[model samples]
Target: MTVEITGIILMFLITVLFAYPLGKYFSKVFKGEKTVTDFMNPVERFFFRVCGIHPDESMNWKQFLKALLTINLLWLVYAFFLLIFQDKLPLNPDGNPGQTPDLAFNTAISFLVNCDLQHYSGESGVTYLTQLFVITFLMFVSAATGITALIAVLNGLREKTTQNLGNFWNIFTKTITRILLPLCIVGAILLVFSGTPSSFDGKDSLTTLQGDNVQVSRGPAAGMIAIKHIGTNGGGWFGANSAHPLENPTYLTNMLEMIMQMIIPLALIFTLGFYLNRRKLARVIFGIMTIGMLCLVIPTIISEIGGNPAIEKMGVSQLTGAMEGKEVRFGPAASGYWSTVTTIISTGSVNSMHDSSMPVSGVMQMLGMMINAFYGGCGVGLLNYLIYIIIAVFISGLMVGRTPEFMGHKVEAREVKIATLVTLLSAFLIKGFTALAAYMVAHHPETGWAVQPANWLNNPSYHGFSEMLYEYTSANANNGSGFEGLGDNNIFWNVTTGFVLLLARFIPIIGPVAIIGLMASKKFIPESPGTLRTDSWTFGVVTLAVIIVINALSFFPALALGPIAEYFSLK
Candidate 1:
């Protein structure tokens, strides 16, 4: 027990220790400063020129978003068609079939948005051709998409007033060439060394000790698995995700994978400070975000480590904690901590089955997605936090009877409205969609739909309600983890959550970038004694309060209907 707790603490400390230096490196990358990866400059220039792009060209926020959306749309159309015809393409040693149209639509958007919510299983549903072209290709770009968009926000925040942030194509190219590509290369090597597969070999027939024959799926998984975590694009090479023995092989790999997922998200906080030259401000933001993580994770760890009381009611000893749906190699403590981290960071990878976690742990996982800002996903996580900060800074200024100024710009109604709408959109999508699905279950469970609503849920009553709620929440947060207790492979979930996934990923991103761009164009205000000290501990408390209140108001009732209700029912 003590050892597992220690290991969890050590994992977090190692990540932060590594993040500090990486943040410094990130600061340099965004500023167009020289770096160790300058060797990639030639490759970047060649790629840009081939694509008819000028790396030196600058763009305003609107133009920047235009380029981002245009490319994403192109990729979506390309991936959808390719997925629908994958079986006819190359790389099908396993003779895997092509995806159905609706599943293809959902899968393409899910990966394209950096939300790798798989409605179809990884190994069987996708050929190695689609896996490499659609899944892996999108993982790289979608993550780069979020991070590069964040660079725009960072550039805007750094300036007192400016119209253009930077060149989108240039930042995008450099982000992939210098940062993401190198990191994935290194991560892929480490994973392969640690027993993850890197081969293109198809299913290998084998006989177990009990003489039963099984065909185990194998492929070029190490490369995708690398960015799957490092980019926090947590789609798996296998259906079991990180829990698969091949994907995450050892205890060392578990720690390594978690650290890789967390590094950029945490480092970006410090990068924000370095980018703005406001180290104190970064510290405050990091402190608040860390506290948010602890609040969610501590309860999860304790509950999971405390074992299941319902199981304790039986004669079976549970001194080893709740081991159901968890890996024996990782143990409950690490799995509980992982459950919280993956959900909060929007990585959405799992080493344990979340549906089998204690109901209290389920609430924490949902809360992580509901809040959706603590450490967040890649470059986008910082963007999510900035929205909360804007709202907090605005409210704090109103209370103090002063103009709200953040980083030398006034907080106005336009910015606040954008932030509020983005915040409310999550509540709307999750609750609104879940309500519709629930209505279908109650009123039309036996409808003539292809996949009946009566069979949608794998559990009954309150726990069943949570399965539905968790799916949409995951989609809305752009966190692709599922309860796995929901039978969501059908058209109903695929199409509905498809729209939710699209709106949720882009809108929150658009809100922050737009806000920062607007603020960057506003007249600069010099610091006054009357000006709020945004970097102080006082502002941290205010931001924390705003996060709590907004999330509670937006999600508390829905939570009560799902995980909260189930927690007590277990009792």
Candidate 2:
């Protein structure tokens, strides 16, 4: 328990130290004020000339918003086609086709919306070409979404005086082409070097321990892993998640994966601060996120380290840690960290089986997903936090009997409504779908579905309920990481859960961005005595509270059936 707490603290301190300078660099990228801007200037001008665009003309809100909407729609259509005809395409080693209609729709929407849900293993159902196509396309769209939103926010700032349409496009393109893509490329190469496979060949024959021939699933795994972390898309090329040696491979790959997973989200905070010309505001948001991360992670480590005494009495060695569903190479510390990171960011990638985690550890991961997964990707996380910050600052105003303001902007009714909606949407999806899944698990047994003795249904109690609730929460949050105990590939999971993926992902992005667009339209309000300085700890506590209340109300009953029951029944 003590060691886990120490590791949790170390992770926090390390994240802060590493995150600050990275944020500084991203700030330069967003502001378009760095020395690199000079190098990009001529190239930018040449493109403008080629396209017959004037370098001096700024883009208005309408133009920026239009470009965002159009690009996403196009990506959605393309991804849908590719997913639907995946069987007809090449690289499927297992010779699987798109059998289920709902699965096809679910997968298409998942990748389109940047959610990347995986019901089957990638190496089995998908060809190498398909894997590469999905990976590359996802990286582009996910990175583009982040970069575009950021550009909008930056342009919104400039809209106060100048809305350079050319400048906005130039910034957006440069960030995607120059920064995001190149970084992902380098990250991918490093992952390959760390032993993650990057190949296009079909499955290879392998001799199993039982002297049986097995077809080893293979694909463009390394290529996908690079952007997977960069874009914060957690889907893996293999169904074992990151636990498979070929997928994660080595310690160096593990570290790289961790860094890549978090780098963008952390860096964007600095970018946000630098763009707003208020480092303090960025720190407040980052600090709040960091604290939330620790609150979840600390207990997770403790849950794993403390071990289950009942299991130990059966001669299971606690010293080896909770080995069930965890990779031997990653061990407790690394696996626990990865779980926390994936859950917090909405990445949903796993190096371990989340279901097999100790009851309390599992609960901690769930709480993080329900709370902070809002600011999940690069641009989205900070933007989501910003909306909440505005509201928090506004509330702080009334408490002290003063007008609350954020970054010289007043928190008006519209902003408040938008923030509330965005925050509540995830909660609604998680709870609503959870209820739906519970109704199924309870009703399914009554319908005489054959139940295997070893299945989650064997318990016919809270454990069974836990399996269903976990599946629902995992799907709806777009946190594709799963409990692994439920038979969710049935028609019920395919259709209802797919709906959760769409809502969880698209709603959060569009909702907050609309608020950003709205915020852009308003003139910056000057700070006065009543304006709350959100950088303080008091506001941080409130921000944390807001997240907790939302999750508690939404997931309280389901969690009680799941982890709460497991914890109490352990004795």
The CA lDDT of each predicted structure is 0.92, 0.69
- Quality of model 2 by C-alpha lDDT: 0.69
Give a tens-digit lDDT track for model 1, residues 1-571: 9999999999999999999988999889878789897788788878988999987788999999999999999999999999999989999999989889999999999999888888878889998888899999999999999999999998887777898889999988888887888888998999999999889889999999999999999899999999999889889999999999999999999999999999989988888888889999999989999999999999999999989988999978887799999999999999999999999999999999999999999999999999988999988888888889999988998898888889899999999999999988989999999999999999999999888999999899998999999999999988899999799988999999999999999998889989988999999898888889999999998999999999999899999998898888888
Best model number under TM-score: 1
Candidate 2's TM-score: 0.89
**1-571 in candidate 2: lDDT tens per residue?**
4554465456546655776776677667655566543565677667778877654456665666666667677766676677678788876666767535666666666666555667666765555656777656766676667656765765565445343423445666666655677678888888888877777666789889989987877767787887777777788888887888998987667777777878778877777677667677667776778778877876777677666667888986688577778877777877787888788887788999887888888788777666654446666666566666666766676778876655555567887887788777777777777766566555553544343223434235666676666666666656677776676555566677778877766666666556656666667776666557677777888877766766788778768878888888886
Measured with C-alpha atoms, the lDDT of residue 56 in candidate 1 is 79
Relative to the unseen true structure, what is the C-alpha lDDT of residue 131 in candidate 2, on a scale of 0 to 100?
Answer: 70
State residue 121's C-alpha deviation in candidate 2, in Å. 1.2
